[model samples]
Target chain A: MSFEPITGRYLTVSVEGAPRRIYVEEAGQGRPVLCLHTAGADTRQWRHLMNDAAVTASNRLIAFDMPWHGKSLPPEGFETQEYLLTTEAYIDTVLAVIDGMGLDKPVLAGCSMGGRIALQLAALHPEKFSGFIAIEASDFQPAWYDIDWFHRPDAHGGEMGAALVSANISPFAPEVERWNTLWMFMQSGPGVFRGDLSFYTKDDSLIARLGQIDTAQTPVHVIVGAYDLTCTPEDAERTARAIPGATLAVMDELGHFPMSEHPEGFRPFFLDALAKMPVATAQAA
Target chain B: MIETFTHIQSQLDASPHLLRLGRLFSETVLIEVDGDEYYLTFDKGRIVQVMQGPSRKTPWRFALRTDAAALSEFWQPRPAPGFHDVFGFVKIGRGRIDGDILCLVKNLRFFKEVLGLARSKQEQAA
Candidate 1:
């Protein structure tokens, strides 16, 4: 089936006790399915998913640009700031968006940093989401590598964004999709990418807390790309096994940013995972 | 032409990105550009030593060898085709990545950003 292009609007939400504008995009209608993007990326990552006729036919698909990302400007008085995305700030922003938009028991689906946050959302506020779909997420990701250079201010004019261009895409991905993925990287801010990794590799810890997540109350599904070196399939397997009744799927020929890097190739797996997620249990108070 | 050890060291010293990227990397990396070799030592996140010639006492985690031309192309403000990334060069056999594949993959972004600093220096020189 065919559908209209996804459209977006500015959302003014309270961040850090001050009102800040966020960009939220939407398509279709029914039970809301909130899509979150990877670190340093914007809502554009969900364009294909939002456009999928089957996805939007019965679900109101929505995505948003986090504060200081995409069309959403940095918070007030922080224009000149070198953004550092902390776990507290990231989770707070997501909660604010949900409350401000009045989304009732929406399903949460995210990849990478977003995937990590989806786990956090489900764990901390299980009553708020019906189910959680996490792609390329892991618990207790050790800081095995470094990215100090990417956040360096003096490194300006450097091709810091280019660093992510070819790093994660599967070598076998289609040429058009591969270049499109690179385009997204080239558009991200310099320090923002590094700042996002600060949390992805460091702060967002779920190992000790995974036990708190009850899959019976809020169903959870994990998807890992077979070619993802950063959040390997092994990592997702361990995470899935930790959470009771959490299902895991390993997608072949896909890498870190599966949602965007290979949307068409990724759609079937995403649909299958969605079909297996439990229905909404309850609504937020 | 790309600057030598001293200049690159100073660049790393000035970049917060480099400092963070090097934090967990406490190894000596041997970089060979067109057969000219350079050794970089990291402590914490600081580049402790950068010297010409080969490393003596320490075993390097990786030795990434590529010609001067490929390096130059990769550092262009907007590199086309084979110049966009190291993997691109590897695809065409213009670059060779040897040593720990795991280490290379994990820290790929850091290394790429480190190399990308060349564009800033080159632009400043222009």
Candidate 2:
């Protein structure tokens, strides 16, 4: 199906009593599907999703840049230096976007860091989302997963980003997609990636709270790339088994950034998940 | 400026992160800077030997060649685009990697992380 052109907007939202400007992009005209990006990445990851007929024609596809990411600048008086992403801050930003846009329990879909937060939001506030689609999301980061290499001053700018992109993405991914992903990685502001990794590899947690999710109210689906070394298919399966009624699917030959690495390549798996969503969930949204 | 063999050795030894990455491989790799060559002999991921001015007898499994300026730029605190990666350098004709594509592919991250130790040294000295 042909894709629709997406329109972008800058919304002013209040955070911690301070006004913050966030960039949100949208297409289509039905129920909203709030798309959250992976840490250090922006809404560009969801461009293909925003354009798809399955989403745009029948769903309100919305994606926003988190604070200090993409077009969303840091809040007033906030230091861009030593920037770090915190669970509370990230959740607050997503909440602000939802409230600012007046979205009602939109289908929350995210990859990696976005996936983890979607899971958290689903459990902590199941009523806030109609469905949770977690991609490359895991319950816990292995203890040995150390990001200290990024701490070195040298591990900034293009070099660090190159290392990260190489590690996260599979070598067999399409060359154009690989370069596109690398382009996005290079545009990241200094310390932004390292800061995001703080949450991805450190802070976020949902192991003890899986039971909080009421699947009847919020259906949770997970898809992990078989080639995703960071959050392997095994990790997704384990997490899926922990949450009652949660379903898991493994996307073959795909890596961590399935949606962005090759959006066309990732579409089938995503469409399959979309088809599995309960009919009532769409009606409810 | 030509980086002293001892300086590179010290830099690698000082970084715990680099050490962890290096420990993943046990191979002798040759690095040619300008016309000069140095052989880094690794024993189970540790830098066991640093032979200056080429190796006469040992057969290296992998070799990378680049000029001093490119190497220097790569070791900077924040390297620019072409200097940020080995393959990137090769792509731009500033560097080349040869011999054993398998070994290079298998331990690509290890090699990248370990070589990044040069920049960490500058960070430490600062």
Candidate 3:
């Protein structure tokens, strides 16, 4: 059986100053959620969730190519995960897209790298969002991260930028190996490596800065695949622990992508997370 | 306020002690519910000093005038309770406080208890 997204496309937008083509898709509406992808992958990671009743019944979900991959191409050398994932640049592109759509602060949801961006976005500008949900966010525990692994010698981070690009954002990848190949391709691109490095070796102090997100009253959902090695189960707890009153749900027998690996697993949690946001908002006062 | 205090981070309310140990507070903590700030000194995630900020009664800055003696009386480490139990405390009156208060959960595992899986499928296969 092949997985397909209900609404999908290679769209374009001029946000974060540079005009970039972003792979995009939009479906349903109640609340809006900006879906984020992993370092090397495009929005395809969230493809399974689009048709999910939990998502469709409660909110509008939107996802697009990050600056350099998919339909949105960043500069040839925009390799700074620090820059690509910075709250300023990341927020600018998202807000631009939001303003482009004229919607209020939507629930910012992402997994792994995307989750890192979601955390920063929530922290830097809590006023702009309704709530945030993340799956094993990288920035969740910045202090514990192993920075050296990102730069392993076998990892070709700089030279294959172009090939890495093609592998990452292609509209259609035929098989799981092809998809996995595309997912792993980021290690070869200079821009994505820096982005990965930025993710793994951040100085943002999210560990200490968690209290700043004010989750005691805000609804933030932190999800983790029990067997996710990329970020690991311990890392998920660290992230969940960082927020006050934030919901932490660990998927059993689940790997990296909860929304994809187990839609049955993630659905109820997604609905619950959605349900929690409004109460969080009402309670925030 | 400090004498009535307990460890009051955002992660405390749903912490594991309630499920595994059938308890919420560790024997040590006294609690204060002022406004935004939640200060705690713990032994096993038990509340020794929960210096919460002012309730809806005053502004968050009120925690500044904390009762030092009561707070100091409870600072020690014990096996932490469920880390998430602070959620209830935060929800009660501190619900709107800043995100920084979540730091008080001494041991993360108490709150981050993973629900499903006793063993991995990959392991079972092996």
Candidate 4:
């Protein structure tokens, strides 16, 4: 019988004084790499990375679905309250996961909203991480589309969400992978995508706090896709410039969801970015 | 313009699955290239009529406006980054969408796919 090398488990983590059963997945073994998914998405976005033998060869890749995402259910009494992911709450959840998993200085890698939080993590607690791979991230990204479209009753939230995101995937990406990425957005729970956007688009810009990120302690590598209009290469460039010694790479023939839209194409850029990180570089040495 | 839209209609009709995906979509949409206007009416997934207009009487739920040059570039087999998608066009200031955004977003996939038929036609012609 054929089987994949990945393993999945559930961990109880506290977010805002409430217990949340977070779904976590891991593969391979070595230097830990904590993967964070984009807004409205889950750990499934990292499936390709986790399954790849090359990436997993010397890295223990770990990914988890945020509360109210994927297999992770929201805390009890979720129906009564409107879900909103504030910066404080998001950071708390990540900290809980890192502590619960007992990861010592793991390389933090995230995409889009996940990437935005990576910057926050760097500024707030650079000592906790060895490096950061911020993909499709920027300090201040203005909301490009109406958030209401993702949840209004007049529209099919799933399809509308998927449709909006689908445009951001490169036309060159494999048809199957492109569809798979859209499928994830399509599966998002009602208001979940909207709630996530509350932080992504409406939250305070990191421009003011970016100077606090000490790259000497923890390296920051920003990667942006040329075709990602939402967080353009210019945005990433501006972000890199703000943080002293931070590096930026603009990947061609790619879009917003680089890793999910075309993993094979994204692997080289990802490896190159990872190689620049102190922890990964030391491991290679 | 009529011929081009006619070709789009035929191309859209050829794809059964695309029509099925739009089974719930039925609306009239306006398409403006440069200054010329065209009204496209859809009934449950099929484009039944394509009417060119300068007439103000034609009511449409939504409208997508762009220059002829921009629309042509958008129809290319592989357009540039900002010209790749409708939203991309809007984001980059190459296109403008107006009227009831709810109607446009509710049937977003269907509308996008329908408009994308022009690209397929362009590809075939090339």
Candidate 5:
């Protein structure tokens, strides 16, 4: 029987003084690389990256589903409250996971909401991470549509969520991967997408804090898909321009969920971006 | 143009996935290309009628309006970034959607696929 090289485990991390059981997956051996999924998504987005032998050869890739997402399961008594992710809450969780897993300044990589938080993490705790990869990320994204529509009783949350994100994928993407990306969103729990978007679309912009990022100590790499209208190439460009020594790559024929939408096409760009960060080698030493 | 609408209707009918996606979607959608109007009526996932209109009486649950050139661009097999999807069209100021947004969002995949059928028609014609 054939099997994947990846392994899954659970890590109990304390965030906000509450013990949360987080589902973590890992593959490969070398310099640790922590992968963060997009908003309303889980660690599955990193399946392609984790399974790629090229990436795994020199990296021990780690992916975890955030609390109330994927296999992580909401904290006890979650039914009574509306889920809203704040920057502080998100940061605390990442910090907890890193410390809990005992990663030695792993290279941090995230997409969309994950991407935004990477920037936040860089600004707040540059010393904790060796390098950063931000995909389809921006310091600030204006409200595109009413977030309420995502969880309305009249609308089918899963279908509507999938449809909303479907436009963000490039038409040139592989058919199976494209639908797979949408399938993840379709499986999202009701109101969970909106909850994540609360932090995503929050008016608090990270523009001012960007100056705090020291790319010399922690290399910052921003890669964006040309077809992502939601977080356009312009947004990524602006982000790259804000950080001194930050590198930017604009991938053609890709969209918001590059890693999942077409991993084969995304691999070269991701590898190239990872190559630019010598911090990985430095951390390994 | 009427022939094009008819072709889109036929193509949508032929798609079982689209039909399944729109199983409960029943509504009339207005497509206005540079002020020229075409009404598409969908019932239980099937495009039952296609009508060209400048008439005042035809009511639609939603309307998608764009210029002829923009619509043509959107119909390209691999459309440029902003012209690729209905929301992308709105984002880039190439298209406008008005009326019952809930109705449109509810069966968004269905309507999006319906509009996208024109791309295959264009491909075949080419």
Candidate 6:
């Protein structure tokens, strides 16, 4: 229901080796914001927010389909690999995008896996990202850090219960909802979830590693919907703890994809973040 | 097709409150008696842009862009903040209204007509 009056044509890029298809909307171009979608969500996830006055007024919103998820082709057998690898591969792809698009460093904004990827990319190549606005990024570990872990709906649960699990997925459409869920699950597969969970849930902790990194000192803004089912308020608090001084904006009556769910609320918040970022970063296209 | 005006002429014609506009450079008038600077532009007698605010660079005023294609086929009803069933015509790019306040309120009818074009366009598309 929340959509911006903006649409973009599709694009293909050579990230992590092969060609990947992406979509971008350039409106009232100024500085650029490279947007990454959550796991299971393509660039379409940011469709409404891209149209947000904050993004369109003074910035170009660049959204891309994660490999194997949208129009992009997951490398041969790579689809069978773990997600951490996908994240690694995706970073390379994102780097290629910056160079390919001939864009100077941009602020990286993403949600969920997209959020985690943003953080990882910033950690690895902080110079490329001028800032971060990660929303409901997955717990470095799904089991340990995740206060509420995703699971197969209890078999003992009734069809009504099963319907709840199914509905949490794609809200649109009826038939093939199961396939939709399976397809969604396959893209982020259990393997990747387990692998990332190891690093995220490791006794060692990724925050320590992230804290140690002396990358580009870009501003970080952390956001989570007040009603986020995936990343609870606690998770958001912890995220702020890890990224000291991170601006945390919580939207009411919004879910995991708050920006998409409640643009009226999220738009202003995101703009405020942009308004606060270094003027030069936001000033340049 | 409407005739296009250079600067001030365009501002005078598109504006519903022209008398209050006085001069482009002399006075920065709002829509009503105390509104923002509202301007209307026409090319070949056809209106191209209707704006309320200071200028076009970063239109703080809500500048609704429209062409003939938009005017003829007003978009069908959908849902929005101000409209009941009208989606209004889209004039490409984002709409900004900030400088003058009254300019927006005074130009609602003219804006609605242009938006009507968008509303029709949706009907054809759907």
The interface root-mean-square deviation of each model, in the order shown, is: 9.3, 12.2, 18.8, 1.1, 0.8, 19.6
**Cα lDDT of model 1 by residue, B55-75, tens digit:** 477577887888888888766
Better of 3 and 6 by lDDT: 3
Task: Estimate, for each residue in A1-285, the C-alpha lDDT of model 6 and write its tens digit.
Answer: 875566666667776666766655544476778887665445655666666675677777787665554555555677455444355566777787777677777878887667777777766787886787777764363541221132223211122122222212212122343333334333453333333333334423345545643333777777776544446556776866676556677655445555554455567777877775555443353
Q: Output the lDDT of residue B14, model 1.
A: 94
- Predicted model with the maximum DockQ: 5
Record all residue pairs in model 2 with backbone atoms less than 3 Å apart, i.e. clashing: B22-B45
True contacts kept of each: 0.09, 0.03, 0.00, 0.79, 0.79, 0.00
Which residues of candidate 5, in runs, are more than 4 Å off? Answer: A279-281
**Clashes per prediction?**
13, 1, 49, 0, 0, 42
Among incorrect, acceptable, medium and high, the docking class of model 4 is high
Candidates 3 and 5: which is better by TM-score?
5
Q: Which wins on TM-score, candidate 1 or candidate 2?
A: 1
3 against 4, candidate with superior lDDT: 4
- The better candidate by DockQ, 3 or 4, is 4
Q: Is the docking of candidate 2 incorrect, acceptable, medium or high quality?
A: incorrect
lDDT of 4 by residue, A102-168 (tens): 8888899999999999999999988778999999999987688888778877666878888888778
**Model 3, residue A116: C-alpha shift (Å):** 1.6
Query: What tens digits encode model 3's per-residue C-alpha lDDT throughout A201-265?
Result: 56455666666787753568887754454555677787777767777877654545555545555
lDDT of 1 by residue, A1-285 (tens): 954678889989997788889999999887788889987788888888888989888788899998777898887777677678877888888889999999988899998889898998888888888899999999857653455655554453124444544655664467687767766666777677777878888874777778899888888999987666668788899999989889998887787788788898799988987787654332433
Error of 3 at A47 (Å): 0.6
Better of 2 and 4 by TM-score: 4
**Clash pairs (backbone) in predicted model 4:** none
- Cα RMSD, model 3: 18.3
Deviation (Å) of A96 in candidate 6? 1.9
Give the DockQ (2 decimals) of all models.
0.08, 0.05, 0.01, 0.81, 0.84, 0.01
Worst 10 residues of 1 chain B by lDDT: B1-10
For candidate 1, the docking band is incorrect
Clashes of 1: 13
